[model samples]
Structures are given as structure tokens and as C-alpha cells.
Target chain A: MAYWLQQILNALQLSSIYALIALGYTMVYGIINLINFAHGDVFMVGSFCCFMAAAFLGLSFLPALLLSMIGSAFLGVAIERLAYKPLRQAPRVSAIITALGVGIFIENFTLSLAPYPKVIPPLLKNITWALGGVTFSSLQLIIILLSIGLMFFLDYIVYRTPVGMAMRAISWDKTYVPLMGVPVDFIISITFALGAGLAGAAGTMYGLAYPVIDPYMGIMVGWKAFIAAVVGGIGNIRGAVIGSFILGTVEIMVVAFFPSTYRDFVAFTLLLLLIIIRPYGILGKPRTQKV
Target chain B: MNMHRDILLEVRDLQVSYGHIKAVKGVSFTVRRGEIVTLIGANGAGKSSILKAISGLIPYTGHILFNNQDLQKIPAHKIVDLGISQVPEGRGIFGNLTVQENLRLAAWQRGDKQEIATDYDRVYTTFPQLKERCHQLGETLSGGEQQMLAVGRALMSRAKLVLLDEPSMGLSPLLVREIFKVIAEINLNGATILLVEQNANMALRLASRAYVLETGSVIMSGGGKLLSDPRVRAAYLGA
Candidate 1:
């Protein structure tokens, strides 16, 4: 029973991280209609940024986290301006290819800087609480709380703010939004920045929980989070969170009960089945074009 | 009024093509201040193409001058900042955003938040349905309400000129009448309007001057009353 409780706790921690990163993918896709393939590498960069700030600059954990978020946001804005903006008028396939190329570039760049995985020094690794025979670390608590907080903040910004409205408008019809005097590019850039910032925070928390960092770390986790986004219904924040938890719990439970090697296949099979059943995912509404 | 003498928008020999097919060819017209200038045409008559070109959505070869400034050199967003707002065809409101958010996004380029707030109140007063569904997502609004939100959004920009593309499309007959009434009211309140419509009768009724387009070219041009002439009635109005 304790082992089962531990697995649940682990699943929750993993889900929180996936939920945070998946929000970025979902939000960007919602607004721009482009799957930011490089989003995963942004997570990798965020972890590395945190590593550099903490290990090299000798900054505290909090400051390092902030620095990582800022650095990732800057990178997000630059990537959007340099790589994605030019492809705005191009076909969707071209943009998708460009996103893949960007992902490769970021991964290669990080590998050149730090070729091998490094263990993140354990600062908050000590167990902070025990509930129902399950131990919870401070890192786990922080990850869950921060993820929830960021998700709520993002929901507020997207639903309650003017910029959020512009983002939604552009998502529906790009040409009309700009004619209303809203600078569409600026709003799009800001959306990229916000999504990247959330991913960075997720990265920081992920490093703290697992205490491992590598250039390729973002690929697998990024793909899983993206899967979570699709599972929950891409472009819906609530869906992303719900999807993350479902994916995380399912993966953990499968690993516990079945062969660990089958986990990846199971997760992907679920994604494929869900897509076939409902292409819009769980939370996405079907959009009908006017004649 | 006499303010129609002040030309606000001038398009000279504008040509737009989609690869091998030309959508708008050598179309030219002028919209005067405080007058409703209507462009009437069939589905393939290039009325929308002209509006798209004027707003810089589609690349075109032509001279579009607003207040004597060349519009061809500027981007679409800058065109909005230059005080021209378009309520696109099918009432292109952001389906996921609320009525208030839709209005707020329209005034994004403006810095006076206070005045923008006042404008919000003004829009709500003009479209009470929008006020009642202020918190509801745009997609949930009825077709007529969406059209009102689209116009309300354009008004929030505080534009000197408003371009309406098929505002009465996909609406009930009663709703169509209400939309036309709002368009005239908006024009009377000191905003130049360029209305594009397939409904020649309604367009002519609301506009001071009218242009008839056919297959990417202007077929006729005259006072709005002339659109009801025997020849025009037979050709376009199906008399």
C-alpha cells in the first residue's frame, strides 16, 4: 500500500511537470496554428540555463529559476521572430518543417555546450512531509503548487486580459484582428514568451525533482508533455492539466504493473486511439467555417 | 452631407491577382468623408478582393491613397493605426473571446485606456445584446449579435473610416434591416463608411454613391439612385 502511495506521488510530480510544459505547446498551437516542435528544446535550454546560473554564477535556487525563465523567454521571442515569422505566409508543412529544424538546432547547440548529463545538486531533496504512509519531498510539493499557480495565472491572462482576446482573435482569423488596430505580431510574440516562460519554470522544477540534466532531456519529456496536450485537447489549459495527470498516472501504473519497456508503446497507442476517436482531443470544440 | 466633397480614400487602377487568375483588375474608386460609399457586385465580382487589397491583406499593384498618403508602402496593422478599420465578411469575431475582450482588442493600439473604457460603454449601449452577453464567448452569440460585435469592435478603434464587408450576410431579414440602420447611424455620427454588399438594393438604399463591379472590373458608377435605373435593374437587380 505504501509502495502504491509512493507511485501515486511520483505520478503527481511527473504530471505537474508535463502539465506545465504542455501548456506552452497548447497555447502556441491555439494562437498561431503551429506546433512549436522546438518547444521541447526550450525546456532543455531552461534546465541548462538554471544549471549555468546556479553552478557558474553561484546564484541561489530562486534567482537561478528566475534567470532560466527570462533566458528561455528571450530565446522563445528570438526564435519566433527569426525562424517562425518568415514562414507565416508559407504553407503549414513548411512551418512544421521549420519547427523541427529549430528543435534539432537547439538540441545540437545544447549538446555542444554540455555534452553529457549532469546531476543537479540536491538542495531541497530532503523529505518534508508524510501523509498516509507516503513521503512527500519539498521539491514535489513546490512543483505541484507552482504548476497549479502558473496554470491559474495563464488561464486568467488568456481569459480576462485584452492581450488574451487579441490572441484568440488572431487564432480564429488573423486578417480581421490586425484590421481592428491590434498589432498581431506583437501579441503573438508575447504569447510565445509566456508559453516559454512556463516551460522554463517547469524545467527548473523538473531538475529539482529528478536531479539530472542533459541536452536531450527535453526531447522525451517534451514529446510526452506534447502528447499530454493532445490528450487533454490541444489549446485548452484545463485540458492540458487533466491530460498530463492522466498520462503521468497511466505511465506510472503501467510501469508498475507491466513491463517498463511497453510504457512508451502504451502511451503512444493511447494518443493514437484518442486522435482517431476525437481529432479535436477531449476539451477542444469543433470549429465550423461559415459558407 | 456636404462633407462628402472631402475625398478620404482614393484607389487608382488597383490590380490584384491570385497566381494566374486576376481577382481584381484596374478597380478605382473614391470614398468621401461622412458619406456611405457602397460597392455592389455578385459573388465573384471582386468586391471583397478590393477591400482586402485596400487593407493590405493581399498584395496588389495599385495606388491606394488615404489622406494623400500612399497606403501600398505600409503594412496592414499600420493601416489600422492610420484610422481605417474593417468589419470583415461573416462577422469575424473571435469565437473564443468574450464581447468585452473583443472590443478591448480593437482599441489595442490606442493608449488612452480611460477613453477606451468610455467607448466600451458606448458600444454596450448601442448593442444591448452584446452588453447582456458581455461575458459570454463570441461563438455563443447569435448571427446578428456577432455582426453587432464585429461593428462594435470596429467602432472601438475610433477609426475615421470604417470598411464593412457583407455585414448583412447570413442574417435574418429583420436582422439585416437592423444592421443597415446601424450602418447609417454610424455614418451619421461622423465616420466615413465603405460598404461592400451583394444586395444591390440595400446597398444603394444606404449609400450616397455606388459602384457596380463584375468579374474583377467596374461595370458602372453613379449616384446610388442610378443603381435602380432600368438597365442596372435588368442587369444586376434582376428586374
Candidate 2:
């Protein structure tokens, strides 16, 4: 029981990061139906932003986190406007190719600037707590709790607010929404901002936990989060969170029971099996084309 | 032929094209205030295209002046701010949204809270069925109910000029009558209506004036009683 509880805690910590990055993938896909391949690099930028703030600016943990999030949000919006906006009317293949190119550009750009991985200095003092034979760290608690808080805040914005209503409306029919006097371009920018901001938060948390920052870190993590979004349902919010936790648990359990090297193999096989079983994903509703 | 009447919308030599196929070829018309002006035509006659241009949905050449302001200067969103709303063909409701949300979205530009609330009441009063199904997803509504919701949404925006493209499309005869009655009521309440329809018989009955469009041009024009004209009867009324 204690072993299981510890594994669950581990799952939650990993899931928090995955869920954050997955939301960025899901949101960009939901509104524009573009995969936004650069989303992972945005996550990478977040970590570096936090590191720069803490190391150079000499800011504390909270301020550094905020700066990273805000910086990432602006970067996301800039990417959408400068890179994706002109391609809005282009073929789906063109837009997708452009996304891949953008991702590569960000990765290479970051690699050029920082050729070596930098250690993130410990901002939070290490404190461990054991409850009923289940040991946990303060960083784990903060990551889990903050992920939940951000998710709830995102949920409120997407479901309750006027801007959220416009987002949902745009997702339904991009052509007709502007007729209602809603600024479609501006709303899309907001969506990008929110999604990237969440990714920034995730990047900061991951850096704190692992204590290493690199330009290429987002490559693998972003892919995993994207898979989580697909498993949950690409366009569904609640599903992304559920999917991340499932992926996190499965990855941890696979390592515990089997060779650690089998981690990616088993995780990906499960995702493939799920796709074969349910092509539209867990929460995705099959759309009926109207004549 | 009263030139002194209050003109709310004027389209002069307007032309629209898709690729190389010109959909609206130098079509011109006027919608006077306080009147139901209709354009009746066959499938490819560019009736809907003209409305699309007026509402800034597509790029067009020539001039469209809504209240004497050039429509070329307006974007699709700003067209609504100018008090012109189009219930585009196929009742473009946001299917995932609840009926009330659909109505509220139409009021996107309105900032006055109290007035918006009263407009909600007015929509509910006009379409009581919409009121009952306000919380239901838009796609769940019956065809007639959806039409009502579409019109209700147009009204929610405080539209002075409502451009309706085939409100009677795919509806049963009884439901069509209900929709037409509501259109008349909406007009009586001081909203100018520009209706486009294939159902010439019903459209002629409701319109104060009518234009006959044939293959992207206005071929004929007259008062509502033009239904009696032998040319109209032969071509449109199917005499």
C-alpha cells in the first residue's frame, strides 16, 4: 500500500507537467485545428526565461515564475501572428509544415544561444514529509497544487467568461463568428497566450523538480504532452488533464515492473492500441458534416 | 418609384466573383427604411451573394452604402456594429453552445447591460419556444425552433437592418408560415428586412417591394403586387 501511494504521488508530479503542456497542444488544436508543433519549444523557452530571471535578474522564485509565464505568453502570441496568421487560408499541409519549421527554428535558435545545459539553482529549500509511510517533497506538493489551481482557473476562463464564449464560438464556426462583432484574430491571440502561459508554468515546475534546463528538454516532454492531449481528445479540456495523469501513471508503473529501457516502448504501444480502439479519442465526439 | 423615400441600404453596380466565375455582376438595389425588401431567384442567381457582400462576408467591387457609409470600409464584424445583421443561409448557430449562449453571442458588440437584458426578454417573448429550450444545445432544437433562434439572435444584436438568407429553407410549410409571421412582426417593430428566398410566392406576399434576380443580375423589379404581372407569374409564380 505504501509503495502504491508513493507511485501515485510520483504519477501526480509527472502528470502536472504533462497536463500543462498538453493543454497548450489541445487549445491551439481546438481553436484553429493546427497542431502548433512549436508548442514544445515554447515550453523550452519558459524554463530558460525562468533561469535568466533568477540567475541574471536576481529575482525570487515567484517573480521569476510570473516573468517566465508572461514572457512565454507574448512569445506564443507573436508566433501565431507572425508565423501562423498568414497561413490561415493556406492548405492544411502548408500550415503543418510551417509549424514543424517553426519548432525546428526555435530549437536551433535556443541551441545556438546556450550550447550547454545549465543547472537551475535551488530556489525552494528541500523539505520532505512522510505521511502514513508515503514520502513526498515540498516541490511535488507545489507542482501538484499549482497545476490544479491553474487548471481550475483555465476552466473558469474557458467556460464562464465572455472571451471564453467567443473562443468556443470561433471553434464551432470561424467564418460566422466575426459577423457577431467578435474580433476573431484577437481572440485567437488570447487563446495562444493562455495555452503558452500554462506551458511556461509547467516548464518552471519541471526545472525546479529536475534542476536542469536545456533547449532540447521540451522535445521529448512536449511530445508526451501532445500524446496526452490526443489520448484525452484533442479539443476537450477535461480530457487533456485525465489523459496526462493516465500517461504519467502508466510510464511510472512500466519502469517499476519492467526494464527501465522499456518505458517508451510500452507507453507508445498503449497509445497506439488506444488509437486503434478509439480513433476519435476518449472524449472526442465524431463530427457530422453538414450539407 | 418614390426617389424621396428613406434609403437605408444602397448597392450600386456591385460585382462579386469566386475565382473567375462572377457571382454578382453589376447588380444594384435599394432597401428603404421601414419596408421588407426581398430578392427572389433561382439557385445560381446570386441572391445570397448580394447579402454576403452587404454584410462584408466576401470581397466585392463597386459600392454598398449602409446608412450612406461605404460598406467597403467595414469588416464583417464592424458590419454588425453598423446595425446590419445577416442570418446567413443554413441557420449558422453554434451547435455546441446552448440556445441562450447563441443569443448572447450575437450581442457581442453591445455594452449596455440593462438594454441587453431587455433584448433577451424581447427574444424570449417573440419566440416562446426558444425561451423553453434556452438551456438546450443549439443543434438539439427542431428545424422551426432553430430558425426562430437564428432570427432571435439577429434581433439580439439590435439590428436595424436584418438580412435573412432563406429563413424558410428546409422547413415544413406550417413552420415556414410561422417564420414569415415572425418576420412581419420583426419588421413592424421598426427593423428593416432584406429577405432572399427561392419561395417567390411566399416572399412576394410578405415583401413591400421585390427584385427578380436571374443569373447574377436584377432582371425585374416592382412592388409586392408584381405577383399579378404576367412576366412574374410566368417566370416565378409558375402560372
Candidate 3:
């Protein structure tokens, strides 16, 4: 039972990071039907932002997180406006190719700047607590609480607020929203900013937990978070959170029981099985095309 | 009172084409302030296209002047902010949003916080059924209720000129009468309306002036008495 509890805490820590990044993917996809394949790299840029804030500027946890979020949000908006907006009316394949290209460009650009992996200086003092033989760190608690807080805040922004209403309306039907005088383009940009900001927060937390950061780090993590977004249902907010937790649990358990080498294989197998089982995803509804 | 009424919207040699297919071909018309003017036509006669052009949704060659401002310079959302609201064809309600959300979204561009609150009450009073189902998702509402929500949304935008496209589409006759009554009420309360409809009998009865379109151009333009004209009666009124 103690061993299981420790594993659950590990899962929560990993899942929180996954949830933040997956939300960015799902949100951008929801507002505009683009996958925004470059999202993972945005997460990579976020960690570098955090690295600069913590290692060089000597900022603490909250400031570093905000700086990272602010930086990535701007990057996300720029990516959408420069790369994605022009192709809004283009063929789906063209937009998708552009997205993949943007991801590659972001990765290569970062690679050229930072050739070696850099370790993030500890932003939070190291503290550990053991409860009933289940050991946990203060960083883990912060990660869990902060992620849940941000998710709730995002939920409020999307569901309760007037801006959120416009976002939901835009997501539902792009046509005729402008007639209501809701600036569709502005709302879409806001969506990108919100999503990227969440991913930035995730990057900062992940960097703190892992300590080592590199340009190529976001690739595998990005793919995994995307899988979480898909498994949760690509457009649904609640589904993304649920999907992340499930992915985190599966990955942690696989490593906890079997060899660490089995982690990616098992995690990917789950995604394949999930697709075959739930094609529209766990919470996704199979939409009928209106004639 | 001045004999010459103020023109709220004017279209001059307006042309709309979707790639090679010309939708609205050189249609020119004027809507005076505080009057309901309707465009009646067959299925492909380009009624909706004209509305689309005026709302800045589509690219148009000709000039549209709303309140003496050139419409070509404005974007679609900006057009709405400038006080023209289009209650679109198919009653484009967001199915995921609730009735209240659907209504609230219309008032989004405006900063008149106090007036918006009063307007919500007015809309609720105008359509009590909407007030009753304020929290219900739009898809749950019946066709008639959805139409009501659509019109209510247009009203929420505080538009000076309300362009209604096929407002009576897909509703029962009784419901159509109720919705038309609301439109009439809305116009009487101080809104200039440009309406497009296939249901000519109801539209003609409500319109202060009506234009008949066959292919794209207006074949006849006159007042309510045009309902009795042999051409309008034969083509539209089903007489």
C-alpha cells in the first residue's frame, strides 16, 4: 500500500506537467482546427526561459514560472500570427506541413543557441516528507497544487467569463461569430496565448523537477502530452486533464514495475489501443456533418 | 418632420462573386432609418449574399455606405460594432453554448455595462421563454426557440440596422407569425431592418418597402401594395 501510494504521488507530479502542456495542444486545436505541431517546442522554449530566469537572473520559483509563461505566450502568439494565420484559409495539408516546419525551425533555432544541456539551478529549497512510508518532495506538492490551480483558473476563463464565452462560441462555429461583433481573430490569438502560457508553466515545473534542460527535451514529452490530449478528446478541456493523469499513471507504473526501457513502448501501445477502442477519444463525441 | 427620411444603409452597384459564380449582380438599394425593407426572391436569387456583402463577410466590388461611412473599409466584427447586426441564415446559434451565453455573446463588443444589464431584462421580457431556458444549451431549444434566441441576440447587439436572413425558415406557421410579430415589435421600438426571405406573404405584409429579385437583379421595387401586384402575386404571394 505504501509503495502504491508513492507511485501515485509520482504519477501526480508527472501528470501535472503533462496536463499543462496537453491543454495548450487541445486549446489551440479546439479554437482553430490545427494540431499546432510546434506546441512541444514552445514547451522547450519555456524551459529555456525558466533557465535564463533562474540560472542567470537568479529569480525564484514564482517569478521564473511567470517569466517563462510570458515568454512562451508571446512566442505562441507570434507563431500563430506569422505562421498559422496566413494559412487559415489554405488547404489542411499545407497548414499541417507549416506546423511541422515551425516545430523544426523552433527546435533548430534553439539547438543553434544552446548546444549543450544546461542544468536548472534549484529555485525551491529541497525538502522531503514521508507519510506512512510514502516519501514525497515539496516540489511535488507545489507542482500538483499549482497545476490544479492553473487548470481551475483556465476552466473559469473558458466557461464562466465573457471572453471565455466568445472562445467557446468561436470553437463551436467560426461562421457568424463576427456578426455578434466578437473579434474572432483576436479571440483566436488569446486562445494561443492562454495555451502557450500553460505549456510554459509546465516547462518551468518540469525543468525544476528534472533539473537538466536541453533544446531537444520537449520532443518526447511533447508527443506524450499530445497523446494525453488525444486520449482525453482533443477539443474537450476536462477530457485533456483526465487523459494526462491516465498517461502519467501508465508511464510511471510501467517504469516502477518493469524496466525503464519498457516505459515508452508500453505508453505508446496504450495510445494505439486507445485509438482502436475510442477513435474520437475518451470524451470526444463523433460529430455528424451537418448538410 | 422632414419629408426626406435619413438613409441608414445604401448599396450602389453592389456585386458579389464566389470565384467564377456571381451571386449578387449589380444590386442597388437603400434602407431608410426606422423602417423594415425586405428582399424577396427564389432559392438562388442572392438574397442572403446581399446581406453577407453588407455585413462585410464576403468581398464585394460595389460600395456600401452605412450611416454615411464606407463599409468596405471595415472588417466584419467592426461592422457589427458600428451598429449593423445580421441574424444569419440557419439561425447560427452555437449549440454548445447556453441560451444566456448565446445572448451575452452578442453584447460582448459593447462597453455599455449599465445599458447591457437593462437590455438583458428587456430581451427576457420580450421572450420569456428564453429567460426560462437561460441556462439550457442552445441545441436543446426547439427551432422556434432558436429563432427567438437568434433575434434576441441581434437585439442585444443594440444594432441600428438589423439584417435578418430567412428569419422564418424551418418554423411552424404559428411560430412564424410569433417571430414576425417580434420582428415587427423590434422595428417599432426603433431599429432599421433589412430583411431577406423566401416566405413572401409574411415578409411583404411586414415590410414598409419590398424589392422582388428573380435571378440577381431587383425586378420590381415598391411599397406594401406590391403584394397585390400581378408579378409579385404570381411569383411570390402564391396568388
Please provide TM-scores, in order, for all candidate models, with all chains considered together: 0.93, 0.98, 0.98
lDDT of 3 by residue, B2-30 (tens): 42348888899999899999988899999
**Clashing pairs in model 2?**
none
Q: What is the lDDT of residue B14 in candidate 2?
A: 96
Rank by DockQ, descending?
Answer: 3, 2, 1
Error of 2 at A113 (Å): 1.5
Top candidate when judged by DockQ against the true structure: 3
Of the two candidates 2 and 3, the one with more favorable DockQ, higher being better, is 3
Q: Interface RMSD of candidate 2?
A: 0.9
Instruction: Put down candidate 2 lDDT per residue, B1-239, tens digits, no spaces.
Output: 45544899999999999999999999999999999999999999999889989988899999999888898977899889999998989988888889998988899998888988899999999899988999999989987888999999999998999999999999999999999999999999999999999999999999999999999999999997789989888987889
Between candidates 1 and 3, name the one with more favorable lDDT: 3
Q: Number of clashes in every candidate structure?
A: 0, 0, 0
DockQ of 1: 0.71
In model 3, residue pairs whose N, Cα or C atoms come closer than 3 Å (at least 3 residues apart or on different chains), thus clashing, are none
Error of 1 at A30 (Å): 1.4
Candidate 2 TM-score to native: 0.98
lDDT of 3 by residue, A103-211 (tens): 9999999989899999999999979998889999999999999999999999999999988999889888888889989889999999999999999999999999998
- Please give the range of 10 consecutive residues that has the lowest summed lDDT in model 2 chain A: A282-291
Ranking by lDDT: 3, 2, 1
